[model samples]
Target: MTDHLNVVLHPLVQHKLTLMRKKDTSTGVFRQLLREISQLLAYEITVNLPMTSRTIETPMTEMEAPMLAGKKLALISILRAGNGLMDGVLELIPSARVGFVGLYRDEETLQPVQYYFKVPDSLKDRLVIAVDPMLATGNSSVAAIDLLKKAGATNIRFLCLLAAPEGVARMKEAHPDVPIVTAALDERLDEKGYIVPGLGDAGDRLFGTK
Candidate 1:
């Protein structure tokens, strides 16, 4: 597996991530911070998106300006926690097409079982960015990517708030070509399989649940 993880190690992201790590951070504060960090990371993740020049009338004269090239961009949220990250990215890329992948864990197998999955047409032609908040075991991330590929997404990128080494390795083995953009590359997962020194379940924190 290639050690090609594009972890965003910016100080601001680190500081906010630390604040988010604290158990005392309130829901409102946590949500706000996540959005802020996601926006900053989004800026870095989308740096290389293809652009095309288009003729437009400027304030003074007609001129050609660079705009996003090819089919409309697509944002495929891996449901629940992914939605939290989705909101911030959508604010930055407002016009990008949106899709959802809903998966629930199966108690017996400890595996991600897809409940729902849908995406826009021509995903292969568009630049598709898949969002999920946590890269815990990477089960769902891999599954989501598989579904996207089946739906015709060739050019793909994965965005997340936090990732564990185990998850990174799993993703590397599954899809080395896909670039993963994240705020932090955290320590290993603990006995229960949660990231060590990591913020607790992102879904619970984001939704005010157990």
Candidate 2:
């Protein structure tokens, strides 16, 4: 893990990611693999969450146990593709507050244009995790984080299944404070701004679209 990036190479994560990258993988299988990999990534990103001790009765006696501190976590999913990752993380942190940011990239300009934005209240008080399946161009990811910071989120982390070197550099330059956790860091982006050796368009693969 670098200062701001954690590339998870866990066997399970790698295995599932390989399955996802296959062009012949069915939408149903791809979606399932994404969910499972997201769960594993979620575990890595939240390893050091603040904790507090709480008195609890185990079976016969009262004992102190470590428990999560602060308000419920905030999860911001960056539109259609992000929904796939969000579902799995939600399974682990079921009490986390959910939010969504919708952005689409302009083919000509290669810029992100926001179409929708909605997030939970008190973002400043909770740990926020932003989920997107791929970080290819990084325009939308950076733009989404910009909106999140404007909304008062201070402690934020970016989680994705695949990331390109270009996207990682873009994110590091744009928001050095936000740490990133991903399953694989691919070689580079293709001319069309898709990660080479990536699992294809995550949104389209998840939804069975062209």
Candidate 3:
């Protein structure tokens, strides 16, 4: 195993993470926090994206300014909870193409069962950022990326609100080429397959369900 996974740790992200970790935080607060946090994390994740220079008039003369030059990025959300985080990231990158991956786990089989998936054409040429709110078992996240690769996504990055250590390791072993960006890495998963000390079921909190 690599000594460390390539994870982005930012200060604003840390503070927002602390707020989200609190048990008393309300649903409204939680949603807002997720949006703000996702935007900050998105900033960190997109820092290294390839850029090209363009000449623009600066009141008097045209000078070269670096700008994202290639195809608009692709934001693939892993359904429900991922959509919440996607809202914030989209606020930052408004022009990014959006996609959805819908997978429901089969209780008896203990495997991800894909229900729906749709992505933009020419994914191989665009920078793809696949996001979800939580990464617990890593099965669904890894599977989602596998589907993206199958659809010709060459440059891809995974982003999430929170992650467990096991999930991190799982992704590393299964998809080493894809770097992961998360707000916080929590403790181990509980017997029920939930991240310990996590913000509880992300979908539940986002949707106000049990």
Could you give the candidate ranking by TM-score, starting with the highest? 2, 1, 3
TM-score of 1: 0.95
When 1 and 2 are scored with lDDT, the better candidate is 2
In model 2, the clashing pairs are none
lDDT tens digits, residue span 1-210, model 3: 132344456778888888988888899998999999999989978988889999898998889998988999999999878988999999999999999999865656546789899999999999999999888888899899999999999999998988899899889888888988887788898877789989888888887887
Residue 55 accuracy (lDDT) in model 2:
97
How far residue 123's Cα lies from its native spot in candidate 1, in Å, is 0.8
lDDT over C-alpha atoms for residue 161 of model 2: 95
Model number with the top lDDT: 2
lDDT tens per residue, model 1, 1-105 = 123578888899889999999999999999999899889888988999888999999889999999988888999989889988889998999998999999866
Model 3: which ten-residue window has the lowest total lDDT?
Answer: 1-10
Query: Per-residue lDDT for 1-210 in model 2, tens only?
Result: 898999999999999999999999999999999889999999999999999999999878999999999999999999989999999999999999999999998998889999999999999999999999999989999999999999999999999999999999999999999999999999999889999989889999999998
lDDT of 3 at 114: 91
Error of model 2, residue 153, in angstroms: 0.5
TM-score of each: 0.95, 0.99, 0.94
